[model samples]
Target: MQRSPNLANSVSPTNIGHVVFGIGGSTSTWGNRKSYAESWWKPNATRGFVFFETIPRKHLPWSISSPPFRVSENTSKYKDYDKHPIPQAIRLARIISETFDLENKGVRWYVLGDDDTVFFINNLVDVLARYDHDEYLYIGMNSECHSSNSLHSFEMAFGGAGYAFSYPLAKALVTNLDVCLKRYQTLYGHDHILQSCVADMGVSITHEKGFHQIDLHNDISGYLSAHPQSPLVSLHHLDAVDPIFPSMDRKESLNHLMKSSKVDESRLLQHIICYHNPTNWTFSISWGYSLQIYESLIFPSILHKPLQTFTPWTKVIRPPYFIFNTRIPSNDPCQAPHLFYFDSHIENTTRGGDYILTTYTRGKIRGLPACNHSADDISKIVVFSPIRKHHLNGSRRECCDVLRIIGRDAAELKLRDCLENEILP
Candidate 1:
């Protein structure tokens, strides 16, 4: 592909870097979609040269029309959309490399990202300045989904969110893809395949924790409110309901929250509500109704019990709330899960007052007590120790001492027995 002379001269050849922001779907959607392009792209267009690519939604079920920007049509019959993104990315990278004469010209970097990404232009420039262009592959945010290996630890490079590659690295990736696609056609998902390919080729990837993607659906106001202080250069709003700046409905709410500096608090409370009684089908459909009942009614009741027990000692110390059975079930049992608990006194001490109570059994626990008094059947309980924590810094120690005084193995063990026998029955 020949470079347009006008485009070549319009951008400074010496300082010209390309930000290949890839947008998929038809032209109308791209125009109307609540995205970073609609909000921040035009405003910050002067900061660096901008180029756009639209992945043609031909083989995918989403759309059939040609989009506004240059479209890469996936001629292959593969129905799985996840598999095609990387090949499309590689193709775009090659186009940029050839057009810019990446080797000869002083095009220092190439940033690749999705349409949903909102750029913090000033912060990004600052971040880019710290790295020497020759050796590093800088990823904005690392993916929580992929695991890293010893040979080449997988720090997920954001293919959907934004990631920047140095000129040499971008060139090498483009060169490498020609061979990679030919050898591995079945590896479908973009980020995973890219991670695998890069690692296999002996490329070292370093994570810059400052890069983040907006993957969380439940908490929008809280996330964006933290962005100003956060080291992240780009925020990728991957999920639905992202305000994306200037959108009337959410933007007004966001602005009101930001003005009061209460966005985080509001978002936190909202999250608590959703966590307790989620309305979305995404959450309810996956896990069975029993799981929902545990989260909504049973666990909360158990967690609140410690408060009642310790409440009378208000002069010396406030009673703590025990959060139990907080872990989300996984396909595998070995993976550790997150749990939290808090005491009123301890809550007053920390920035975020809630502290973790003690963890439960590693294996599944059964015969847990029911919240309803009439229920005779004890539900089976599965407790994972690492998941739980006490609210006080030394509360676990205190609990252990109390357990020993009462002739028990450990505080956790004693508590487990008490809940199973006294509380349940």
Candidate 2:
């Protein structure tokens, strides 16, 4: 595809101000899920609206930090809309059309997401910056579970994960969405309907790894800890997955992640690997989220694969558990990873330069013995990284050098760009 000349020489860069969000919500569900949207939505600075079915009755006095609410137009006029099991799918799918009709000025992209979707705003801006907003673009990812993909479409962008439409494409969608919605009233999900409409326009989805549907249930630590080499954008379906951080409730866990996200949104859950050669210990740091320590040296190829720590979205389990390569978690002491969760972080200014110090505390102790006692004493990990966004377009993930053990209970490490021709053996 040819780059638009206007975008190529564009003096102004795409920022949060250029994107408008359309949050799919309802009066019944908005009260409980508003906190997730509030976590990322900035009042006045961020432009967008939460489209609810009706005015929220119980949750009055909406806070300023949350996105201002807009009630969706009644979809009762559409034929056969009432027969759909989840009739709200019609309203939810029309979010793009509703959002575009408002005709917010200077809007380059229209971001669509559920109320439970938590966007990493800065990272989102950075990801969107790579694309030409003047073109007809539809960007998003399919579900993590293979079953979900098989049932709906691997090509469709799951709405809960959030997706983006460029200005031109959104305009086209607004014009035809009502008729398209009528045609697809039998479709079950909002995302599928949207994808069908986009397909009618001959526009296929431009998959971005950063947008996560998070369709799995129970513990999702495995997936988050081994993120793809992309900017962390949005996470959805938080209510189904276990709390990202151990011990904390779902809301608190998200708040805990916000601490590190605020420090460097681009680096949140960015995977970096290093080794302590003497102990043959492999350290996998999911920046700002969790850390996993292996007693024996694990090659980057194996380390990069997420452990199968989550179950499929449905009870019917079949082949192809996940869309990505996942290693089955082992009961063997040698293979089991010692877990650590993000504890705190601080900005450090020194003679050399500015950096961040993030500490990870050991979680609950498993009864299994540590392999050779190499990682037994270690209770905390302190990682130092440059205070800048790690560019995702780079050829490889940034490398890390395991520093000398600072204490009996803690270890330290430093992250830097991988030296040219350098490989993790």
Candidate 3:
């Protein structure tokens, strides 16, 4: 694959994103969906961004800061589309179908994502840099692999996983929008509808692993740890997985992905370096930096080079950490299924800033499509800890914790249990 000439000196990918939320008449529906689009998607939006596109309504509480623009639905043409499920697909298709008409806006790529979907702008651009924006490219990953032989095509990209139309493809779709809309209605799903339209335009779906549909039931540790040697483009099903470490909702996951990719800056969890120790499906754990992966049945098949911040387009995957159910009893901090070295003695700790820890079992929670899965093919568990303020200079004995037993794993891990009684708020 050749690099886009446009990316010669550029630091980020060129993307103009438009987020669509399936409509609803209920105030709560509109409000919840609006909160996600505004609060979650608004901050990280790209240059040619268009915020909340809903049908025109009376006085609604809609506002955003400078830079990325916002678009209210009522002001748009598809405003009258019903809040019903079926019509929502038609409305989304119509909105997408009309995007290219606004060409010459210097947008190399036009992204189509749902309200729940989260985009990793930098990684997205890096991934897009590998392809020419002028090419008729429809880039995204497939729907959940479990639901097969259904209306959705295995080859087509899923909407929630987030699919994008390159400039040329967007232009092509605009020219035949109505015809395509009439050809495939909501019964096929908006994603499928877009796929069929592109197929007719002589466009084939180009698959990428990073764009996640997130159709599983629970525990993204399996997915994240074993994520392909590719930049994570987008993720959906925000309301599913429990938060790990610092955040309480999907935003934390988004923050996690962004920070891991160096998108956002936080003194804590910064530059997490992993070392690939040979073991079963295990790849590697953070080298002596608090976290460790242990227990296994397979010969450490994971081998990953250290991740660099300014990684080149050549690097394919993230630091690898294969997830498995089999356990081993190695006390070597590195070999424990998961070990957290917290300096209970706070004064001696070198890593500055407050310490917080949040966690979830690798494969317990359920999600969107409801995958009836049993295998513990987990990648890594995210720990979202509640913060407790305390002067670290005065401390006690350091304590180390590892997930070697079942009590800590099966407790449906909650935010309350993780917090001390004094810090309860």
Candidate 4:
């Protein structure tokens, strides 16, 4: 198997070499099932990448003779219809592993995906560059958590739309599947099982937010629009099309869409290259501990901090009280803080009262004094403080009174000094 030319500089034959695209189901989107595979999946399988489609025994088409891929079906091993899709897919993957003799091939990367996926190989290549071929078992995208007790929150596996695993890792995964499945039986979803299984193996899972799995009804247009510049391994349009021939004539529509859409290859490649930049920050944050107040507070304050810091290592001077500590969550998109600074210089200055305070919960900007000095218009002198829970019911009067007693002149001088020394050059 050959490797991606872009990765030829770094990826050796022994490194990440082969890409296995797992297409499950008998759904015919184009003319036939096999045609769907040839038109949609095969072209993306560049030099080093191999495409394999897994279909149920009943759905296997005869035209698929001497098919480059092998087909696996649900057997007596999976008597439980309750576990239909997941177990069936797993079994098929195992069969592929054995059929290809991948166990001994030292194949490091295998992308487990669906048939409906349309991928920009260039974007995928960018994602593959981040990890060496040795590191396998990667999930392309994750589903959003909507509930507090959702089991999905506990693990990091994305929609089973598509994922990649190293050959050794896949072997290890199959070896450990029975135990993992037994333990996490309470978790109903396949993705949840995947998460629990991989996490138990201690395999690091890389999540690509740009990888959209079109499971919902309205997702087709939304996903298609997003894909032009998306760094997606592949899109999984599960149940988006039926298995029967001429199913809604969607294949033609899809083909037409792909043809009509102006996919700027250069722009798409640029988008994928830049995709890793945003993710670098996300991966940097350790989610081991719960977020803290200070962490929350600093997140917003340092929204542009990374961009600034990475620019020239040029530190952004901030107020003395505005110290940044990773122990507390900063105003990160993932863990945004409740408090935010009100910059008058910026347009749409909603929060510009005597105290320059804004409601963190409501996102409303209103002007008010640090104290009840509404007439003073001392917005510049009084720095807005975060509404800590302890300050509710006006119980923390001492702190407020102390600042008020310091007087506007002293406060202005202090702020000016801090600004000059800390923020500005």
Candidate 5:
């Protein structure tokens, strides 16, 4: 059998083709972004060039091509919202066209980054290598700030942390942008518009945990040093967070974050794990790896919580840093191409045993029709979630039962206890 795709291994710059960096920022941030590009992306930028698609500004110290993009203050969601110049959002098509023009030069990937976004080029190349760039592809993290994912696809690659477009996708979008422009939210924002445009093209954003759109307002070093054991891809909102190096400047922060791009193994949770359940207690799985068990089964923490509680937790079981690895390859989720991200939160409730649920970030909500997978393909795609068991206060250790991912509704999965592992005949 083939081994799972690994982004840890390094790849050469040539193999990465052309990853066009679409840096978005207003006049105030343009200087900061340019400095960031020179300091961070450019020096390490063997794989791509920074494409700044913007209109000219006075004393801005930079110039851009005037590609005659339409700027509309009107959108389906927001009206008369001229928070920024209209040209900012309109430049997306031009950037794509410029990259498509490089199709003759074998430009394979187009990456979009904010003015403050910092990317680990090596890790990016390695990650992109796992997928075929020739196919219709849009790779990035899901919307961390967008609440209503259903209204507008959460499959959007948050532009803050930056997203990518394969050669084929870039071609389709830029080529048909004029005709497709009328169909999407023009002034909604570059990212939302792009997501709407791509969804129309039958391609969804592929989520990768590495690319971080750090939607926060604090120092991230504490979080980074304790990051999961995966390749650290890209980071955005550098200016928003505390300096990577305490009391240091942006240059120092960027350097420190990049230099310390080492993988995090503090939790030792990596792959998906599956276990057979044979007990009376029903399993409540959430946050991707954490499990909550009770006599009566409950809902996935991701989606909802039952009106009733899981069993009264008299005991607490901490398994000396739980195992997060899984034998199930993520690509196994047949027909539905989604990138699963593993994460968790500790619930220190005064009521019962402190609960923590492992959550998997399900990408898009499309049906399995797009999957077009054979039964064999579906069979091979088993979601091996993590499982562990514990006893009451100072009680004996309980046996480990299985927890299953019932459906794509990560928020709600009915997991029942089974006596034996569900082995296929």
Candidate 6:
């Protein structure tokens, strides 16, 4: 029998160098989708390939900015794959085994995703650090849309959002994958096939809130504005949703978000709730995404739930649309929160320490009325945040203080570690 793969013996903590990516794509779609991959891919630093159905004859020289490309092992020889409705599922599923075959030295995990998937590399590294790579672990999250879950197994990680396997699990899974593919030939998607194979080994998905399947469509601003208290790992299905920030196309919007992420990836899209007791104003900051300023003092519990501003992936399925709790979006202008989109960031070095100031410019929503004149003049929000390490477990959500209005047009807020007994008023 072949010996088990040796685990890395280094005493240092797991870093980006320890992981490799296996991105699934097709030549037909690569031209448009490659931009998404390039946005997050580090050319020389990141390891792995974008496995295409076949390389294009016309697109001769591949750009250096994107991940290198490779053609997946042809599955037509496998008679069992013919039974699957989507023939491409077989090729996509095989990416796992093919990536493992590369045998990158010192690799502890194999992350799989689609061409459209954008990974936050720093956050991804931090998340993978939480698990023991030597163990048989499957880590990822399910879809946001409940109907999609009803159609597909909720236990399975959605491939578009991406998922990871500890080295040992991937090694073992690939050994039995061919048989599993043949056995589960009726499965609709590659993710399901892999999930079926992983289940046979008695492993379940370790859900991480940060990995977004983005099963919902239309303006996802509401969902993103109230992110769960976790470091964002990946975002998929950019083509399905509207531009994250208004006035920009999908690629430009992604580039814009990356600006703040470059400064501090740990804080990107991490939610923080603060209040101005004097004006009874509520501020919901989805760091690096958008900020919503409410006219009333919304309770922390209520503010934490996402506002259902987008439609479900499948209209065929009925009520209770999303898996998580979502408050009905208000039509009343007075109740609607004033919107502000991230515009730019400024990094500062002081004798005390280093901090980042991200600016969010107000977006004019046609019917949104100013509930309070106190906040009417504010056109921008400048947030002061000191860099801190992101810990996935047993760590309290950082709190923020609404500082004095800097000018008639700009609002300032400062972030700080919460007092043990502190509660938002």
Candidate topping lDDT: 2
Tens digit of per-residue lDDT, candidate 4, span 1-425: 22346665664543223555554443343224443344444333332222333443344453432224444543445435345345544443444344334434545555554445565444455555545665545556654222311325434544444666666666777677667556665565545565667778887667655465543332232122212223434544433433111223556544432331123221221111000121121111100000111111222233322221111012224422111121232233434321221122111224332222211111122332222222122223223322221111112111111123233221211011122233211
Candidate that scores best on TM-score: 2
Q: How does model 6 score by TM-score?
A: 0.94
Give me the runs in candidate 6 sitting further than 4 Å from their true place: 1-10, 80-85, 349-353, 365-370
Candidate 5, 129-229: lDDT as tens digits: 66666679888885333332333456777777788888788878887875555555344567777777888889877877677776544544324432343
lDDT of 6 by residue, 73-126 (tens): 877777645543567888899999999998558998899999999999888888
Ranking by lDDT: 2, 6, 5, 3, 4, 1
lDDT score, residue 334, model 5? 33
In model 3, which runs have C-alpha deviations exceeding 4 angstroms? 1-30, 33-59, 65-85, 244-283, 286-292, 296-336, 339-425
What does each candidate score in C-alpha RMSD? 17.9, 1.7, 13.9, 18.2, 17.7, 3.4
What tens-digit string does per-residue lDDT give for candidate 3 at 1-425?
23446564564544434222221122334444444454334344443334344432442433453123334233244333333335556656665644444333666777777766666655566567667676799888875433421336776788877777777778788788767666675445777878898999888888786787766544444334434445556767666654433223656444444433331211122112222222221212221122334333223233222221111112225422111122323333333344232111112222243334333223222222211221133323433222332111113211122222232232111111222322101
lDDT of 1 by residue, 365-404 (tens): 3234433221112122111111222121111111111111
- TM-score per prediction, in order, is 0.44, 0.96, 0.58, 0.47, 0.51, 0.94
Residue 360 local lDDT, model 3 = 29
Of the pair 3 and 5, which is ahead by TM-score? 3
Off by over 4 Å in 2: 1-6, 80-86
lDDT of each: 0.35, 0.87, 0.45, 0.37, 0.46, 0.85
Candidate 1 stretches with Cα past 4 Å from truth are 1-28, 42-68, 73-104, 144-154, 222-230, 238-248, 251-425
Better of 1 and 6 by TM-score: 6
